[model samples]
Target: MTNVLLDAHLNAKLADFAGSSLDGSPLLVVVTKSHRRPGDTCCVEADISAFASTLYTIVTGQSPYHDLSDYKIDERFVHGSFPQTDSLGPLGKLISRCWRDEYPDSKSVCKEIQGMC
Candidate 1:
């Protein structure tokens, strides 16, 4: 449908996924082919959005970029223009910083999350 509708759906899905406590591990680790953290990429938004998107996938069993088929998904990622879902709620804002290259490393991200919870 519309971009707004897709974003709303993704946000709802993110909330569902990120809102609950994990069964065992407090933090989830994601590894990508490129050694750098997704957010480590030049485009801060792509990295941050990648982390959020991963959480969205875990919770919703769908791709956060599912809506954009016409454009090369990779291009969208490189430009850091992907739509963000509100599923992480407040956490989403914190993680957004990661995308923006605010935090120095994952350790900082962890510390921030721990402080938040």
Candidate 2:
């Protein structure tokens, strides 16, 4: 029982994010201009999804890091932002498509995403 908690907005975001990332992909990409990208890290969608989902769980009191999908997965192997050249394979692309499809309109995207994440 991981006592996770999350703000109202984040919860919604997580849901949108999860829904976006639910497709069958080995990895998903995330690029945050605010954050520093590690030289030996890649931002795959699944990693982003897993990170957000687990973090959301941690915040909302649903699950724990230990209980989420494989936590050992890391981006350091690819050393990039899951670029097309990054070689994430078809699964990654599939996840990317799902994610894009899930992208809500700006008017509702934020609020919807916040509700899940």
Candidate 3:
């Protein structure tokens, strides 16, 4: 398992690294990025970047980028550093990015919700 660094509010902790566990567990997917790297070698970020970004947004119905001033969400590609499946930072922010991108405006959001409903 690879151990990547996580920037916590207080301090970063060392945790085990897993991959694509999202397909099985929503809880694990939500917390995948926050997970600390147990060692200092492996990096699931590279391995699951493409899929992780997309999966995260689709599952949470949120964005995937941290700073999305001029961004848009698309299940096809949310490339960049992330927590789960990636090693960005807070999975929440990233998921939000995906949502914003997926739904560029209020109209889109309603449409998305309607589709889900």
Candidate 4:
């Protein structure tokens, strides 16, 4: 069996070196696999970035435009870059704001999503 503490320690070390929690840096996709439940969908649209982020988590089990590069997962979160994913469906436009800086901040992004919803 895997030592849970060891696993957590390793993950923490990796995150510390990878700048996963750094500000002004790309949001990292910490979780390797999608944690969303089957048929899970995000429909909550609010004027709060936290809420928007929550909604995004519900849909993809990831932060908006996550990096995930350290884990050998490529999310392609380059500046002014956006990838096409069918999972987002109608939420694509709203999530695009994270890549394109469409919103001044997360709050604005949430507002945009709320409008779309």
Candidate 5:
């Protein structure tokens, strides 16, 4: 069991570094608006956005702006344009809040998710 977990961890690290999933799908690294700016320090908002984006990808099997180039995606994110989430139901709403920086911190996001479950 330890070996299994270690292998999974190593595979995930490799996939992250390689910019693709083990299955060869492109891996999207979620970057928030603040993260795109020069000299901006990492914050809880970034963490929240990342978590939401990752959840979005897991549920949808693709990144929010999977069809766009990195430059285009960054530009859209800077301009506050995010992928539609209506079909995602409750999860979609949560993703929207994270993207919009509505939550105070990552803990609130977790609390909401726990409440959902």
Candidate 6:
């Protein structure tokens, strides 16, 4: 499971590094809620959010908002309606913080994760 999580994390990071096209065609499955808004650009917070979402996917064996259509997913994220993380324990709390933009940057998220170890 740890290996799966690490692989997913690396893949998500690679996709992010590849950069989004003008049409925003990249990693929409793990995009931050703020980035779903019009004219919003990627930021450190976005990276944290994406990483959190990726972790959620790996841990749960499913994508966040998996039941929703792309349009509906965008609408839900724009409205701050993320899937529940209550059952996920500590990791869920971390994911919640990232989705809520509570962390200032990825380093902060990394520190928190390191502490979890």
Index of the highest-TM-score prediction: 6
The segments of candidate 6 whose C-alpha lies over 4 angstroms from its true place after superposition are 1-16, 20-39
Which digits, one per residue and each the tens of the lDDT, describe model 6 over residues 1-107?
A: 12232364455324333445456454444434323432344556655666777788878887788777778877876777888999999999999888888999778
The superposed Cα distance between candidate 5 and the true structure at residue 47, in angstroms, equals 1.1
Off by over 4 Å in 5: 1-41
Which 10-residue span in candidate 6 carries the lowest summed lDDT?
A: 30-39
- As a whole number from 0 to 100, the lDDT of residue 101 in candidate 4 is 41
- Candidate order by lDDT, decreasing, is 6, 5, 1, 4, 3, 2
Residues 9-66 of candidate 2 have per-residue lDDT tens digits of 7552322332233455432554332121233223343344334334333344443223
Task: Quote the lDDT for 6 in model 1.
Answer: 34
| TM-score for each model | 0.46, 0.21, 0.21, 0.36, 0.67, 0.70
Q: Encode model 3's per-residue lDDT on 28-88: one tens digit a residue.
A: 3323232221122123332333333444554555534444432232221344334343343
**Deviation (Å) of 37 in candidate 5:** 8.3
Off by over 4 Å in 2: 1-41, 62-101, 104-111, 114-117
Candidate 3: count the clashes. 20
Q: Against the true structure, candidate 4 has what lDDT?
A: 0.40
Model 1 is weakest, by summed lDDT over 10 consecutive residues, at: 30-39
Candidate 1 error regions (>4 Å) = 1-50, 59-61
Q: lDDT per prediction?
A: 0.49, 0.34, 0.38, 0.40, 0.65, 0.68
lDDT at position 40, candidate 2: 22
Please give the lDDT score at residue 43 for candidate 6. Answer: 55
lDDT of 4 at 60: 72
- Give the distance in Å from residue 12's predicted Cα in candidate 3 to where it truly belongs: 36
Q: What TM-score should be assigned to candidate 1? A: 0.46
